[model samples]
Target: MAFTGRDKTWLRGPRAVGLLAAGAAVVLGLATGGTVTQAAPAKPKPTHTQIQLLSINDFHGNLAPNPATSSSGNVNGTPAGGAEYLATQLEMLRASAKAQGQETATVAAGDLIGASPLLSAAFHDEPTIEAMNEMGLDATSVGNHEFDEGWHELLRMQKGGCLNDGDGQNNQNSCPDPKNEFKGADFEYLSANVFYENTKKTLFRPYTVKKFKDGQKVAFIGMTLENTPNIVTKSGIAGLTFTDEVATANALVPELRKQGIESIVVLLHEGGFPSDPKAYNSCPGISGPVTEIAKNLDPAIDAVLTGHTHAAYNCSINDPANKPRLVTSASSFGKIVTEVRLSIDNATHDVDRLNTLANNKIVTQDVPKDPALTKLITKYQTLVAPIESKVIGHITTPTVVRTNDDSLESPLGNLIADAQLADTSAVTNGKTPVVAFMNPGGIRGDLASNGGAVTFGQAFTVQPFNNYLVSMDMTGTQIKALLEQQFSGLNGPEAPKFKVLQVAGITYTWNPAAAAGSKVVPGSIKIAGQPLVDSTTYRIVTNNFLSDGGDGFPAFTTATDKFFGGLDIDGFANYLTAHDPYTPVATDRISIGS
Candidate 1:
């Protein structure tokens, strides 16, 4: 039977199905004409997609795990961290997210390398870069330490090439493997605020957009601390300008919005300190420069992942619109990973800020190590063994740590200050330095005596910056002004935050309760056991980083005469050799009074 168009429609309609079923109810008949009616179908559920962000900061090239007993080796009393273990943890985390139908991105705030252990640093951090690429880092911000070797070198790290400096330059062998030359980072390094002075162009891309298979997109804006110049070697960042973090970020919101990206995350290299440093997951009374920056950020920013203070905290800070936003930091050395979940509205293509959640997951050592990372680390360890294992000296104590006391002085700090002084004293020129000041921040790690024998590796870990020593002349009044500067304006907005200089061949009493500019007690300053004369010029020595006004000590820049010496690490190694079995120094040079 050939069916007409009307007959085809009737056959396909519910009338035909109802006739076949024999008891189905179908509505018929309207007032003016014959019609059929049926109920409407229900609507589908709204789509909400999940995005997982796995973040780490301040890794500092810790390819191998710290000894299980060391504080850095554990998180909340459980053994954690190492490239192998961290890789394994990240893989498992990604796998779990994949099973849950969530997309994943792994990112870092900053300091993935620089001031690294011998195994990584000896090859100019090539091994660390290789390992990171293997572990699949999506992106990272440029940290202050990234400028340790200058911006050009940082570019080399990004673009990939062999250093023009042949192997063995600066005691580092570049392109050690002829077969596998450095191929640079597979991940992008974003720097939103750092720009070349002449061109005013960002050193790298300002931000990056990651698109999912379903067409939703999120953007990441990365920047380091604005005060990077004050802490890093001035020469390294001479031609660049680092702008305000908040301003740079706010200005980009419109640009990102124009591109239809409503979800944004900032990977900032600055961080805050939690009241209880050991509470990895809770943010109790968190305060620092980062807090003010976070509070002032545009409400469009969904989350902020931070680092550089190396303190772990998970906080919900209120944005400019008085909306709570997720802010988090994982502890340094790959010990912890912050897992942040964002719920994206498919219809709006925007993050549902109210549904955001974050947590700090310890990279526990209980899991099996990633074979690939283990193989990479083993390759570098074998190459650095000769230099790393050679005994440099012996330490009497089990470990000369950098833990500061009430007076804000530490055993390692005192030891480094004395080493700089001793290294500079050999200058037969009549302008010998009378004192040496070491910024506490320069001492990166403790000198651990493994069975009482300290290897070159341990010493290198303590002072890995390889900064050169600089001796200069400063008047007694200027020195006092330097001391006053530590407790006041020069540091940062985080004032009243003290960075007391570790000193050698000098002593002074400071009034703890005194006013900001008067903390150094009058008539208490002394040099070489004699009262400091305001008119006398005293020769002082410090690392080039400080002499050029690093760590907020601008007073060092006002010195009269300057004499550059050997590398600070070499001097430290020489000092250890000269002392043989070194005893920990007493932190009694600086006295505190009521």
Candidate 2:
């Protein structure tokens, strides 16, 4: 549904912008039933309109409170998360703004639901979306994680409905109680850069103009990182085209201007990491894809709210015009909410960029909880408690760490890789897999065995993608090519270094400073204590994500004789159960240039 001329607030910029209209495109349209209500006319434009914009990102549905590590935040060492706590903080912030006679609206940079814990993933992320609806999210950009279950499922997430992808109901959301229907999101989802392959149209609304009461409005252009194709599953975005973020946002500036809109905010689902991870609101030595992107954005964009990197930073990045602009990210999970008070100059219909104040407010448990959110979380917790608490394994040690050494290998990754290798070996039927690799991003969290008990929920949280295992035959030469391909990064513009994969049943040395194709030292690779020969065929096993060429590893697609194994999480649990009182193996299979 294209935005129709219905009320004063229905200011759709152009017919070609392809903004999701409120009616026909029900799946991706706004939840006001395709219509926006009108606000009374203003007597006169004030000199300034101070509006509060509350933002969050990478909230992967941590309904329960999490430690500092899972959220990548610890302001002087404090825990965060718990939908109730997050909601209470936002509510309090918004109330304070209203008290000061300021309009308030909350938005997010995306990742509101993918890569979730067992509590949310078990119900197909319905609980997360519901929590968002209750928390009063106004709009957001679609992050890469949103495509984890594929595009159609994303549409279902926006337009409320139960998933029916059967087979144990993982993808299927057959609500046991019909009254608990998924009512969809009341907020809007903006994706200015995501387009269709054949039709060349946007997958969702490119931009949405949120009109407030005093003739003041702000246009939000939401877009994910253009490189989403490289990180996400090939099948999830099979026919979608993710354009360059800068180009896409720049082209839309003129369209937004035509609608008499001046104040602009980019709900960008891409961000950077600050040098100090604990400094939730300060940008010191910020570096990543977003820094470069923010510097090139059009000056028309006043503020850029970002995410995806999962790190928090409040930066005044210089735009192409060499003008300082607001760029912010509120860490990950429900830990922090970035508060930006934009003072718009009504006289000039422009943003007083210098006066904009933004900071990340920690969602500390010290505050009271939102009853609504507490109820919502409790309902789901009760439904999932049995499955979540069931003991799946045991561990001798109570502590596990995922922080990588110089080799980019960690105990958590090693455990996952070895588990994957072991699962394939158990079901090989004489075929036999010699090596297995696990992508770093797939290892969501460290499997801590606190209290020496491993719950099903903890295991599921470690491998939440529900990806299956795939065994394929690749010659030793192809195997080397696979390892070398990790350095290729992808077939596109240059990007940050690829994350090294965790390996089991293999050991090799590589020089990071060496030339791309020759990074691996010669005669250094060994599989099961046997030298790798270029001509010998070797069976390899990896998660389905890699076999489909995800995470920039195209070499995985070159393998032949593919056989689908069991689910990755299942295999991991089986391995843990098999090795009860399991102890994390030493991380020595990887070696760097040092």
lDDT of each: 0.79, 0.76
Q: Which 10 successive residues of model 1 have the least lDDT summed?
A: 17-26
* Tens digit of per-residue lDDT, candidate 1, span 1-594: 121221111000010100000000001111121111111221222477787888999998899998778788888789989999999999999899889888788889999988888888888788888888888888788899988888988998998999755666556788877888899988778888788885646887777777764677877788898889998998789898888888888877787788788888888999888888987876667787777887788878878889999888876666666666677889999999988777778888877765556778999998999999989998888888877887889889899999888888888988898899989533547778889999887888888878888888889989998788999889999999898877877653355368899999899888878887788889888999999988899989999999999888889899977888888888888888899899997888888985
C-alpha lDDT (0 to 100) for residue 433 of candidate 1: 82
Backbone clashes in model 2, listed as residue pairs: 1-21, 1-25, 2-21, 22-34, 163-173
TM, every model: 0.89, 0.88
Consecutive 10-residue window with the lowest summed lDDT within model 2: 21-30
Itemize residue pairs with steric clashes in candidate 1. Answer: none
Q: Which runs in model 1 stand beyond 4 Å of their true positions?
A: 1-46, 164-166, 424-430, 490-497
Q: What's the distance in Å from true for residue 174, model 1?
A: 1.5
Any runs in candidate 2 off by more than 4 Å, and if so which?
1-46, 68-73, 165-176, 424-430, 486-498, 512-515, 592-594
